[model samples]
Target chain A: MTFQLIVFYSFAAWLIFSALMVITSKNSVKAALFLVLTFASAAAIWLLLEAEFLALSLIVVYVGAVMVLLLFVVMMLDIDYAALRQGFVNKLPIAIVTSLAFFGLLYYFITHGEFGPQNYANPAPKGADYSNIKELGRILYTDYFIAFETAAVILLVAIIAAIALTFRGRKHRKAQVISKQLEANKKNRLKIVSMEASIEETENSGEQEPSTAEEKS
Target chain B: MTSSVNFSIISAEIFLLVALCVIMIVDLFQRDKERKLTFLLTQLSLVSLFVMGAQDLGLERQVGYSEHWIKDQFSTVLKLAIYLGTFVALLYARPFIRERNLMRGEYYLLTLFSVLGMMIMVSANSLLVVYLGLELLSLSLYALVALQRDSNIASESAVKYFVMGGLASGFLLYGISLVYGMTGTIIISEIASYLSANQANLMIQFGLVFIVVGIAFKFGAAPFHMWLPDIYHGSPSSITAYISSVPKIAAFGMAFRILESSFGEADIHWTPMIMICAMLSIVLGNIVALVQTNLKRMLSYSAIAHIGYFLLGLSIGNDEAYSASMFYIIVYALMTIAGFGIIIFMSSENKDYQQISDLRGMGRFHPWYALMFTLIMVSMAGIPPFIGFWPKLEIFRLLIADGQVLAAVVAIAFSVIGLVYYLKVVKEMFFVDCEDSPKVSNSRSLKIALSINCMLLLVFGLMPDSIYQYCISAFASLN
Candidate 1:
């Protein structure tokens, strides 16, 4: 194979393997990290397709932002996936059948259907000076404005969901409770008490006191 | 470039977004435990939105923003209904949240966002908009389910919903990618036109399967409905009520928008699948629900069965049946909300009354509320002279008329089976006696809201054509 061909096939293989691991890995953190690998390899594939902007975004957005958020959720929720999977064997047959059927359908389409290379012809090689990001941005701002705004709203919703679900405000956070702070007075905020000392500490204090008295004399 | 961006048409959405932000800022400054101002502001905006949606109804169907946003009778009517439902839900939610010390402003904010998302879904003209709207709605719902953070059950339920919802979304996104790859377009109207003209290829068929799965999952139809009961049982009752009611309309709208837009001509493929889900959901939801003692869990299974009925109406592939399904969802929201509201009502600061046994001697102690509860449960059971009966009647009639005789018979049978549990609750409330006197909710506003909600069922059941005609006219362009 040519160099580019070798690179693509290798990345594609990596993409598939990692994607499989994403589901099969029992540890959620491992699955999440495998998801990052999946995204990275997918982005590499996108770069091979000469879509530079998409590759970078796939890295910056999905791998960086979305995966980080997902990791946080996995850490925060602490769901018992093991307990959730208590009846795995009983469900395995049906799940396997469903997945295999889907796979078979996809296989049929990939091998024998009209959704083929002829229907989606590859683009001509672009000049090195070309910028798809600029082109994509033009349409994104002008034509797909509504979809863009809706996406922005969805992001806003994600933020609200995160804050609303987990933020405990003053309870768990070190946030100052203004009312409690304001209500604090000298007696409540500070405590001063006279106490009898233990034997050693008392004797040490007495000696120190006598020395200080001698010094005063 | 700006020719198609009709700002006034989507001004309602813009208004809501701006109002939501304003409320957020205002709430940030508030120290009030009840969040009274936030609630008032949210209700006021929802009222304004209801009026706006009403004004927009019956207008000529308008497409704007490069045909990405649509304003038509189909959307406007549903939007109005959603607005009204959310208004009542929040009013009922107030005391419930207050009692539990969960009365943060974020509850109203998330709910408002969810409302905004539903409105977007109804009016969305493109697949991208539909996906985004679905995400906004679902994310808010998941958060709201988990809002009572101190409860272990609530948090676990939220986790379950989040996972299932994410899987459903993934299925939908995969389907969307396949549809786009096959059709070379993401505009829903263009996709519809194309699919109507050409035979679907193998990939399109595969994609439609995923789409249907996603739709069924969102509707909580059987086999894909693993998450509904646990969530309903585990979440705060007020949140359970909210999720059960307003979002059903949005789900109906999303399914219709996607299915009708993507596969109306290829109905032969998807129809059988939906019919199967309907029967499965009906049988499973009813049978499993029969054993539930907790009213919330029982109502959740009932919700699943109701989804089956709604799906049955929708499967007929005609304007009349579509409207019938629309009416079913709207009425289901009403009946279900009132059903859950009674449970919310039963709770005071100390106790949450959710068991069927909790209703023991309620009729003996509080006759007026017991009558209201009876009406709600009976309506949910599809009894006559209640709003719930009309939708079921319409679905069965339309199913038979559509020549699906066996499906119709199966649905009617399961609906009868579903009635037993509701009647069981009614029996517990009226006949079964408890040694201790019942402690009904003392919220005046909640009782008033619940009364109005339950009464509308009987009033509209007497003359359902008032709502039925609106549903019919909303789909006037379908033929």
Candidate 2:
């Protein structure tokens, strides 16, 4: 029991530290990375509480997908890190005071509330399956089935509606029709007119050019 | 098995689903040019739903699988009000959708689905049912807000709505899990009974707080209401009309279910929390609305203030208080519909008159519509001779009767603060002058509908006894 308390407190302290780092870090990328750590620690706490499914999904979905996307977007943006740092000094006093007051209230609430160590301990097992994933699926499918289906349908309609709104005809541009290209074969391309040059016309052109050249000379 | 599944309990939801399917099939086969037919069918479905709800007046029944659905007068009254609000909003939405060339069928389908959600929510007897209903309403709203696909603001609003909604749902689900863990039950009545027997559980108290947070967020209470103004501003005027009215009724229903049914035994824990939320929402919602330039955003803030009033009733936690909240939601929904309907009428396809300045000289060009809007605004301000007055008066009376004198005082103060913003819209409509005068052209059907909606507010305001009596009886039956 002592060991478990030690582990839980360590994880909680790590979470709070990383969360604070996420806000106060000078570098944006570092801040995002710290946020990922904070999420990981929180998930660990969830795991400690026997919510394995939620903890794993949180790590995989939020940490893996969402944070990665956020990192990429943040990296792509043209942000002035120095300018961001300049505002910190001006804002630090108020930020510190507010956060301290917030943490103080939160601490008071947690410590003074009825949820003390005695209440936090797990109760005796009731010998029933309370697996998070299993119960979630059962409730979702049986009781909340209508709503689940409605959400799916709403998303489907949103997808189709978005596609329809964006797709438009390009009517004004002159483009090669695929059907016309398909109809044209090697025979149409190879058909060329062969012209024979007339000798008398060629001689007259040559003589007129020479006379003009002599006059100029 | 089939005999156990009582059809009457879920008749309203089943009827709405059937109507939605018919609307969808009609829209699918019909051509785009036949938009008017789609609108007609949508209006017909909503009206029929309203009629079905009205048919069960004062009738007490329980239905659905394992009696997890209820069809008492309370549910019927709420469902009736929601259907009426949806019907009016759809009528107002038609011209806007037609002018924008948006997909009419899908819009109507989503609206129908949202109304169905509200019905399920109000009638829900189980936590699972309540969650399902809330999600249905929320998901439909997300898509509805983004219906104007080409608009960046609409897409952003949809995203904001999605994130906030997702967070609120998480809070609600966590709370549900906690409560389930403590009581081993999800049915509201069962949980209430369990908590009544085992009121010493700390887990139950924590769970109740989390659940109330989720409910407070839905009601647009302060500190959790950052999404409300952005969504109201970003969505189209017609969609805003829908968002500001019916969903609030659903929120009230959910609050009633959670506080009165599930956590009534733990009133010592919840009442004080609700009191805090009520005070903050009232103060913040009113004060923030005072400086708003956009009418929709201002109204959104005003909605938060009104929610504070509703919460006052819930905090009182009495039979009269419950009925007063019910009456308040009905009147609030009507007044909001009338207000947004006027905005819809004035808004043209080429221009959106969302800015308060755009409403300048509107009283001169459209005197009757302007008068109707003024009546709604006044009612919204809680003035007498309007429906809004009765709800406030009833709530205050119930609060005072419950010995919550201080809460009653705070509510009255917030009502005055709310009046300042509502009067701002009125001032813009009547007094402001513009070089280019506003000209509103409405279809004959819409004109008649708007007039009727406004006149009912006045009529109900004068003779609120019947509705008030009905709500009181409904609460009595529940207890």
- Provide the TM-score for each candidate, comma-separated: 0.83, 0.73
Taking the tens digit of each residue's C-alpha lDDT, what string does model 1 give over A111-159? 6657756666678988888888988998898779988998898889888
Q: Model 2 shows how many backbone clashes?
A: 0
Model 2 lDDT vs. the true structure?
0.81
Best-performing candidate as measured by lDDT: 1
Report the C-alpha displacement of residue B377, candidate 1, in angstroms: 1.2
Q: List the residue pairs that clash in candidate 1.
A: none
Q: Which CAPRI level is candidate 1?
A: medium
Worst lDDT run of 10 residues, candidate 2 chain B, spans B1-10
lDDT of 2 by residue, B1-479 (tens): 34445666776677777777777778768855547677888888778777767778878656556546667777888887788788888877777776775646778888888887888788888887788888878878887887788788988998998899989989998999888866777888888888778863777888888898898888778778899899988988889889999899888888888778888888888988888888888899899989989878888888888888878888888788888888888778888878878878787766778777778887877778788888888998999988899889988998888888988898898788788888888888788876676857467777888899999988998899967887887788775
Q: What is the lDDT of residue A130 in candidate 2?
A: 68
- Each prediction's RMSD over C-alphas, in Å, is 8.8, 11.5
